[model samples]
Target: MGPGNRPLDLEWLEDFLALAESGNFSRAAQARNIAQPAFSRHIRALEEWVGVDLFDRSAHPAALTAAGRRFQPLLEETLAQLESARIKARAAHDQAAASLLFAATHVLSLTFFPQWLGGLESQLRLGPIQTISDSFHACEDLALQRRVQFVLCHGHPEVPGRLDEAEFPMLRLSDDVLLPVSAPLAGGGGAMHSLDAAEAAVPVLAYSEPSGLGRIMRARMRQVFGEGSSVPTLPQGVDIVFTAHHAALLKAMALEGRGVAWLPRSLIAAELKSGALVAAASAEWNVPVEIRLYRQRADMAPAAEALWTLVQERPPGSGGR
Candidate 1:
């Protein structure tokens, strides 16, 4: 409410502040980019709205009255709060427009996401990105619940997961291989653990059920080995030493010469090259998998949609490392 109980014009508040700061009507009018008479009218309207005089006109420098002195601080505080609210509202809108949200499995988040995002940045402009790295099931849940724009994880066409079952749109970004690897023996002669060993039961570092790689390995191992085989088969038997949902965790245990573990080739390429980790089995045991990005079928943010378009335009193996 304002003078005559009409709505107040926000410009009048600005005029009041300007006049209070300058302490001169003409100077304040010039500062506010309005004519002197118009600015004076704005100040008068504001005073009427407040139901009191705000300036002592007889003072040498047009000083504030006691009421004006009290009003100045309250007005300054109110204006400051409104400006803050305006800034926050704009910032939130901008963030919603420019931000990208992703949920990636632990392995891909570490081994693949940074490089893949760098490659995309070269082709398109991306804003702030938020990535959640967790187990496959967690990433799947984010995608299913519409909490993120994309999910990056290993997938096999033969073994469809929840995202696939829900018919979420996905792009096969790259190819990856999960292969058996073991730390080298003490004398550096060969791998410490071997799938073909015929001695005591072979120790195995395996994936838990929550891991996407675990699901793929279990399903494919059944096809490669007999119907009942879950992990890679040893000539004698396999003793499950440890189970985890993270490939990097299994890689650490494998590097310590703990047991034979199936790890992604991309993740252990440096180790394989340096002979820190060696092939525990032949190439026939390697499982080929796809590094896939899944998203909801509905429209997404502009940046996400643009990224998906660029990925589709590129060649199949261009982004794989």
Candidate 2:
């Protein structure tokens, strides 16, 4: 806490505690995924509010001042209890509170999300649900604002700290495919004969840019095509590929044979199994991604927990830790 300029914001108290525990602003920012400068400001605001020097500036790794030490456990327990109460309140109003918002990469939205909900309903025995899609951080914002009870997204390098990392015991659905697929049954048939023929004939459908799947495909394509090569085939028949967009649109495009489309095997499983679509190459072209559910350690509602538990119990072939 600083020497008194602002009233204490309990939220800052939490940030102060996280900073104290981590002891490095950069790491703390990464853990928080906010800019370090912004996090520092929050810490400063906290100190200003509390009217005390919370940490020893001269010390390395940010040791807390006597005042901070004295205050830690009290704040932690108090916040925990307050959060517990919030969860109960949410459960009591779950049906009306039943408004849920989560995000997913296109693949999850297309494939597993639907499957998971069906399973979630069967498990929780719920009827009618609401959901939305956006990038991972959007879910983080919504949850922080209490706009959503939960979030689901692909696990990535910075994921653990970006969202609250609780054990969301998952049931893995069948590993899905995201190989190039085509809408025109005839267009797809020729590519099935040989891998070389497939690569040679069509521009591999790829996510447009700056996306996880797109990044993976770009690196892999370079490795396969050779170093310093530009996107091996141009106009590679992109049916407007975007892994971040809605899955249903991608699926519709592939089903229409707009071009060779990379999409989830799980979403197109029935199509592929029925021979309506063919993998552009073998399954080797696609990467397996996760669809984990998350709730903050302090903010899960009972109905939310109930939904999570249902998600946890389903066949977890695809949704593992």
Q: Which stretches in model 2 have alpha-carbon errors above 4 Å? A: 1-96, 99-101, 104-110, 125-129, 135-137, 140-146, 155-174, 183-189, 192-195, 198-201, 209-244, 256-258, 310-315, 318-321
- Model 1, 81-184: lDDT tens digits are 99999999997786586478899999988888998889889889998888899999999988888878899999999999999999999889889999889999
| Tens-digit per-residue lDDT, 1-321, candidate 2 | 444455666767678777888998888877877788888988887777667778887889988899889878888898999999999888767645444545555556656677666655554655445576665555556666666666665543322424544343333344443466665446444443233354334533345442444544445555433344333443232223333344456567666655566565666777867777766555555555544666645546566666666665566663421
**Model 1 residue 216 distance off true place after TM-score fit, in angstroms:** 0.9
TM-score of each: 0.69, 0.50
Best by lDDT: 1
Tell how far residue 182 is off in model 1, in angstroms.
0.6
* Ten contiguous residues minimizing lDDT sum, candidate 1: 223-232
RMSD of 2: 15.8
What's the alpha carbon RMSD for model 1?
8.4
Clashes of 2: 16
What shift in Å separates residue 194 of candidate 2 from its native position after superposition? 7.6
Model 2: residue 45 alpha-carbon error in angstroms = 41
